[model samples]
Target: MAWRPTLIFTIFSTILTQSLAKGKSDSPICGILRTLPNATSNYSEKYCILFYKTISHLAGDEDSTLYLPVSDALEWDVCDETEPPPASLDIENRYIFVSSENNCSALERASRIQSLGGAGTLIVKEKLHAPKQNNTDYNFTLAFIQNSSYVKIMDGGENVTVGLYSPEDSLLPLSLVIIWFLAVFSVGVGAFWSGKVRHKLYLSEQCGHVGEDNPMTCREPALPHEETSMNLSAKSIIGFVVLMCTMLLSLYFFYHILVFVIIGMFCIASGSAVFCCLQPLISRIPCATCRTPYFNIYVVRGTLEVRQILLLIFSFGLSIVWVVMRKEPWAWILQDILGIAFSINVLRVLRLPSLKICTILLCGLVIYDIFFVFITPFITSDGKSIMVEVAKGGTSQEQLPMVLKVPNFAFLEISNICHITDNYNLLGFGDILIPGLLVSFVHSFDLQIGTPCHLYYLVNVIGYGTGLVVTFIALWLLNGAQPALLYLVPFTLIPTYIVAAIRGEVVAMWHGDSDKFESGESDMDSPEEGVPNGSAQIVT
Candidate 1:
């Protein structure tokens, strides 16, 4: 009775499965780890778990390179089959590396390394929960290249290291690229503006001189306009370069750098374009402030909330389409009808009822969205069911003559939602960028008395959101400002990296069973059942 890792791993996986919420399976974890930092820019992340499940049987472990999403953590959970495995309850409660990770509050994430026999078991979970999480302005974002053409074999004897890197690494490269492009475009625009300004001044001088100095007697040599052109162009260029470089460097260190990156990029592009191109052109025209740089804005739309209103409306419509695409209608029924009724009842008892209508409307909208966006996509797919089959000792495979064909429908079906939520994946700096720009805009128009402009207030509410008291005061004071929202829609496809790596590992794990067949076919699923010779189970 030699030690059997397959049997052991099966038990561990079963325990893990018991904790899953039907189709949910801690879906919020990924929201916290991947999407939030990437999209929201609201929270700081300390660490994450990188569950490495080998879909294919790996031969030797020397070549595998594991890249963890976070920089430092409290502990690592290694599900090794041969080693004395840190106590079961300890593994469950995460005592495996608790001593090293004592700085963090708790393990921020959990992951699994699922695979089949003749194999070593490994799962890496890093824990970093320091109380200083609040004091520092830090960003913990991760971008992994997990699924490549390499690292497929899933044999038991293998070694892997989960490499670490600091947060905001992705933003550095992305920001650098954007700033460089804009800097070049700004210079080109300035040159065009200088030409237009000169022409306007020439026309004015000629018109003024027609009645006085002998019908263009000397031409005045144009007053050496080159000096003025050089200064204007130089100022614009210097202003732009300085601003962009400042923002880019700021992102390298800020915890909420995602906001800076997104907002800073747009502001620099838009502001520079206007000052360098549109401003000069408009100045040459009869009117100065009358120039509208972009159509969706107010200077062009004439204080009509219609454009802003329409924008919000269109965004709502797109959100509706998103709900439809995700395929959940019941959630809509509950949120729109029942969720509304429930909120009214709760509000009635509370007695501070000015917001009853607004409350119901807001709650209903959120409820319907949840059903359409998050709740509706909870049904399990055929691939997910396949994991249960293999887990239960029911799957088989066959080996082809030249190449081995191990059909692991299960490996292809598992979820990657867990990994995405680690390290505030949803909360990135760019998430905060647009809002910051809005705040900057409001600052541009900041006033101490009377109501601020509707447009300024609108941008602030729709983008960054002033707190409840602030919103109340602003809306009370302005009465006409309507804001739009930054709606996030999660796509339906599983991340390509997670899908590819898992499938590859499943194939490698079943490599041994290939000895049963020659090539181009597997014995796991029989030809008679139309299961395509997928073989399984080897007692080595």
Candidate 2:
């Protein structure tokens, strides 16, 4: 119904408005300096003022105020308290440049510029420092610029002009929307696919009734060894967290050399992931079902279907192509596709058997994420987050392929303010895969219980989406890098627990009885009891 879409839109609008209202009211103003061609400089350059603070009266508007530079040559001593403005200097209606090294306070600098009839004052400093004293006495618009910008202006002579403006935050970046959709799609499809595979394996384990025409019905189940997923234990979760910490530190210290190694690993892993994701679909094709002769390789021997071989070649070829063309503008499409496939494959292969293990894993990772992203900045020399720096490529030309990147499609020029030149929003694979394990486990639990409509699965998936929205909201309001798992784990885990408790399956779900399939098999053996003879029940 049309009302469904309308209701969703209404909810989204409400959330957006509420989130925006919570954003920082004292957002910093940005400035752009444009240098015109002069005798010494042939080409023009535009520099962004990264560090700046605007006066109280100039805080409301988003419009840029353009000001031409004064023609007077600025000397370090010009703004000194001992030296007043030169007799010949004319600063009327022009923005005057004042360096912090002039041994004068910001208020004093602004007052001197105001007395000289200047339109505004630009104070250049190495870093931003709020005035210890009140700045209300001087009314002219005052802002700070980086020392580098000041040097450039001095070199550019009087041909430099600046435009100051406060950037308006986008209601929501389209990149975030796309990333959310991709995350939901990846987790949902991966869970469903995992459940289907689990169901098939469960059915294959059963000893069906023997038929005279087909004795193979009594044969032992021949499940593929490679399809066996690793069930995470409590200790393994802790170990996984430790390993993640080690890897992050390694990447931070040795990023230049290790990035290529990680790229190679991603190529192999993503290729295999693609093959795993596509093999099932391709197996259904009649023409592609041809099998190759069994071949022995050292201790292993197996026959591969024609489709499998073709998919292997195609998947690896695609991965190699992405590595070669990753710098291209359109390459994010391929990267996202491969990344989603990789996440789905990981969710399918790593089984969190119970709610207990899921809780342990999710909580451990949430702490890990928080420590690296939020805590390490205070400890590091450069005062940058280790996690954020590693994720941002850490001075390397190659970025880790373990994230889903969506190019920002917003019309606003907010990328410069955020210090992101590529204008891409990234969601780490851990954010999707860790919580996705819980989602997948719940789907399997739903299948085990034969819950009508998969209520647990549905609720957990919706919780995950809600958590992602909260993460984005926090990111927008704080205007900083966020630990997504801080929001994701609680949202996904708590809802599933609540649903389990309400359904009175809390104990069962917490332990996740693995023998349920065996019990179901035993029940299937007695055909006259209810189940049809020799008929297999497949959970869809």
**Best candidate (score: TM-score):** 2
What's the residue-level lDDT of 53 in candidate 2? 40
- Give the alpha-carbon lDDT of every model: 0.24, 0.66
- Model 1, position 71: C-alpha lDDT score: 17
Per-model tally of clashing residue pairs = 93, 0
**For residues 211-302, could you state the per-residue lDDT of candidate 1 as single tens digits?**
37555554444332121111112233344334433432343224243332332322222222222222223334443222223232311222
Worst 10 residues of 2 by lDDT: 12-21
Candidate 2 segments whose C-alpha is farther than 4 A from its true place: 1-30, 34-47, 53-72, 75-77, 81-89, 97-111, 121-162, 207-222, 226-232, 283-310, 327-330, 373-386, 392-398, 407-423, 477-481, 513-540
